[model samples]
Target: MRAIRSLSQGARTSLRQVLWGLVLVLALPTILVAAAGLYSGYRAEQQATDLRMQETARALSLLLDREIEKSVLALQVLAHSSSLARGDFEEFYDRAKTSGLEEPSWIALFEPSGRVIFNTRVPYGVKLPNSNRMDALQRVQETRKPYVSDLYVGSLTGQRLITIDAPVIIDERVAYILSLAITPDVFQGIIRDQRIADGWNAAVLDRSRRLVARSRSPERFVGQLASPNVQEALASAQEGLLQSVTLDGIPVRTYFSQSPTYGWSFVISIPETELAKSAQRSLFWLTVLGAVILGGILLAVLLSRAISKPVDQLVAAAQTLGRGGEVSDRASTRVLEFDTIKRALVEAAAGIRHHEREREEVLAHMAESEARLRLALNAGHLGSWEYTPATGALTTTPTCRAHFGRGADEPVTYADLIAQIHPDDRALQKESVALALAGRTDLQAEYRVIWPDGSEHWIRVSGRMRSGPDGHPSMVGVSQDITERRLAEDRQALLLHELNHRVKNTLATVQSIASLTRRSGDNTDPAAWNAFMDRLHGMAKTHDLLTATQWQGALLEDVLKNELEPYQDGIRQRIRLRGPRINLQPGAVLALGLAVHELATNAVKYGSLSAAEGKVHVMWAVTSGSGQPALLVEWVESGGPPVNKPERQGFGSKLIQRGLAQQLGGEIKLDFAPAGVRCVITFPISTMASDQSGAAETQQRYAS
Candidate 1:
């Protein structure tokens, strides 16, 4: 202990000063050699710093991708749960609760429009509003692919988070979306695990160049945009190194790698001070060269020349490593220290290259994982069941019990399930199950179940038998609620019949128009033929709009917009249309489409649209303060040529007056004012859906 104290109290001495007193004349050559060595070492150290930074960037990038993959994998697993397809939210909620996921992570179910059905972040049955991730959900639905959303704020947690969404498709349509809300700490954990050194920086940025996780000042900078240098480096290359300043304005050399799977960039920055660390060995050799130079100038020159080549090689090797290129296995140098460094550099280059190869392989696998997530399988999720024939015991998922017409909490047994099946289909189901168990073939059966409420539903079951250790074959199978598909087939047949009846009615309407036009104008007139074709085209547009929605219905604004689209002026708003996107049923849509078509054509031919200064405003509103709300649409024209009432009503006038009443059970009023023509139509929403007018009324309305 006394010796250590005496050593600590000893004064420091300068080697150069002590040596200079003995060899003052040798100082010039020594300074020149030391300076040369110093410059070379500086360059080599800078290159090494860059290579290490680049390697750090790649390693962090791989880790970050793996972290994101975990969230996505969990989301996909939940998305495939059969309870979602069977409309069993309770089972889904329970499964999500026990998902075994870490904190700051939660699951959610969303409709295609972004309405949250349920969220595991909060208790079940909580009133969940629409999610703030509509754009991400919409993209997934459109592309039918898994997506990583940009940084967003969580609804329940109100913290900055990112979402990974996977679509649950049924009947080839995106029925629902499953998502995982991941806090930035999940990514920050990755950085924390790296244990990055002080004076160095690391960060993760989404595709928008916004910071997702930061190694420092995360609370203040987590969601902020990255520094300009980092952004440019990310944009410039898939992996690269560049000289820049940190977000804290510290000069640094930044290394970054862009993830091919998610398009995010991972960055690591090393300070400039680290690069300027002088090499101790090089300085020691320089002092030796100075002390020995006085013995022979030629020998000193020879030693200096000998060291220069290896220094260049080391620097060259580092540059090659930084560029991700192959390094040469050069022979050993004459200098022992240089030889050791050369070998080390060679090994490091190999190790880094090998790591890069592994990273590429991992990236490829992650891409495949993402691709598998997007495969659109046709089977709808419902429930799975396992049965032990020895004990006649049945274990079913919540969805499976629900398919048998039981509640989620209802206890079910094999006998109870068999009793629920229809009498006729029961035998067929038993035969299929028996055949599968005895012959070891796949079990396939379609049977009907009589619910306690007396509603009949179709269930499709498919499964296989597995041999147990006890020499008994256990039965496992999945069942689906195919009631919607079967009903769809029935609806298809009914629609075909309705289509035929509508075709005949459409012909009658066409005949009425031809007859009215023949009496009003000469049949051979080009104007009459043009008017007829135009009306046919208008009808075609309405059919196109309805077909796009599978004939379910369309918005009132869409029907009007389709009819008046030609007169729409983007800058002037000449044909002003103002209304909410009221969802009108098929009957209301068809009636409103034809009514608007007549009004628009008449105005373009003889009313306000005929004058240059003319304008038309078509507005609609749902009547309030009433028992059953009604729809009121008013078509008014102004700044027209004149207000001259037609002596005889043309087809346009009659169809608007009669078709609205026949097809929609509505009333229409057409009036001619000094400015132009005006028309008002009114109907009850309930009556519009019912279509009270029959085929006889339809033929009577067109009868002249």
Candidate 2:
């Protein structure tokens, strides 16, 4: 076997070979058919040759009959002349010879008695023996009709001829018979004088089945039958006829026609083989063409197959490699670069399988690790948080359940966490988060959380943001319960405040005692001494209560009612306290306590609290300030004797102004009205705790 090249060539080669063999098989019949056709033509030509001769002979006979008609006319002209009465017959004879007639070999005139009266070449009054023997004349006289005779030898002229005759009447009765004869030589001139095609002949014949003219060989046989093959054709006088004939044993095809005037036939004939010769030549050329085409197809097939086989093999080998199936090692071929690519792909496919297996194992391990991490976070009550700064996904951990008061299985989100923040603290948390995201502040917020049960707790959440590789900050932080610790610290501070209050109160009591003792040694300044005791006594009363409350704080109304009770007829009924409940800080309690005591002391000496109708209506309460919950306390005294503004700022003024203003972060105002004295002190509510334990006791003692 030869080496194959490509698949396309192989297909083409195989197809061409098959096609070539088919062409040869098909051409075999065509060649045989052409040979048969040539042999059949030879036989047909032989038959045609005979038919042509018969047709030619019939055509000549028809021309001869027409000639006989013309002769009879010429003979009638001479025989009807009555020149034998007037003169000798030589005049008629001379006239007949000079008439310039063609084709007729003899002319004669017969008398009424059936004797030859005039002949073109006879002496006058010749008793022509053949005149009564002329079949043409005898027939015309007997029947009184012109007649055309068949080919016969004339008795007088002794020539083979066709005759024509007519009667010449002398006195309305049978008179004479005039006749002319046509020789075979006249028909020969007619046949030779006409033209015919190559391999064809022309002829004329009479109704007696004799050839009167022939253009070709056998001209000597005029007045004879055409041939044994076509004799029947002329005997029937059929015109427009074509038939095959044999002339001298040679076949021919003939065409014949009849002349109506004289009952003759004209014909033309040709050999059949000559007419069909081109068809045989064409068939031969077609056979040779079929052979050449078959050879070309065979050569094309072998060349095409050489190319197709290798291409088909290469395609199969490449497909095997692509599927990672086994193929020959030599499949790594030198055919083309693409074959090398197929081999490389096979190697890559194997490596890919190994990598794929390893990847699956790694993925499974990662999944396991994730599950464990999720379990630990849920168990530890730790909320896991991951902040992706890029996407802004802040995922909270499982521990955030406590913050949101949600079950572990319950779905929780950042919005739920934010909703749990106390409304008052919500803005601060929002601001902090916003600042952190904006890079202006760290993530730190202390805000109150409203638990699911409606109890509030303060949480301190602090985180340092971690920067990602892209330099954006992300927050991570923790929060825990700090509410109890904050409450404990508040309680401890309140106790310390009480201790400080008691110490300050003890010092004031000692100062008041010394002032009283010094005032007792001065009688020369009674007004001055009275004023001195009044101020000193106010200090002493304030300290006495401070020591009793352990200085947690005191109410303003309690401190006033207690010091003025000794001067009231109906203690509870005489004094009135009006204001919302207010708790004072330890320092405000001390200063306000001293200021009220001084005013009551002074009243017994010089103010309205000194008289019998000295009923003190004291009212203290909180009022609105610029900030919504700011505290204002008003001290109004009424139903007392007339009052005057003090002439000087004394120690009483100093205590209210200096001590309360400096320590309590508030202001004190003293007004001396005509009917009573009005004093007001206002401060912040934030300075006092919600539970006024110490202040409540002072109010109870004063109210009782």
- Every candidate's lDDT: 0.78, 0.64
User: 1-704, model 2: which lDDT tens digit per residue?
Assistant: 12334543566545445655666676677567756766576557645755665556555556555566667667666656767334456776677667677745556667645676666656656665645455455567788867777777766556677666777665455566666655767766776676666577666666765777666774466657777545666566465455576454445566676676777767677666665665666667666666675675575567557655655566667667556767665544535656678888998999999999999999999999999977765564445554555665666654656655656566655677789999998899888887887874557677888877788876767656787677776777665556777889888998788668666764664465445435544634446555556656665666676567765566655666667677666446655666545656556666666666666666666766666666666655444435634455565556677787778665556656655665666777778889787766666556753444433333321120
lDDT tens digits, residue span 1-704, model 1: 45645764694743333344435556675679677977687678767767877877887787777777877787777878888878899899999889987577888888998788888878888988787767888899999878988897766677898888898887579999988878888888888888988878888999899999988888988888988877876777899988898777789877899877788888887787765445655667677766666655555455555655676576567567667777777722334566688999999999999999999999999999866633422235658888889889799877889888798888899999999999999999999998988898899999999998799999999998987678777888888989999999999999999899668867876776677666656633457767777777887888899889877777787898899888877775688877554677776787788889888888888888888788998877656443655667888899888888878666677766677777777888888888788888888766554332221122221100
Each prediction's RMSD over C-alphas, in Å, is 21.8, 65.0
Clashes of 2: 43
Which residue runs of candidate 2 sit more than 4 Å off their true CA positions? Answer: 1-69, 72-91, 122-135, 195-204, 215-220, 223-229, 236-247, 253-258, 266-704
Query: What's each prediction's clash count?
Result: 0, 43
The best candidate in terms of lDDT: 1
How does model 1 score by TM-score?
A: 0.39
lDDT of 1: 0.78
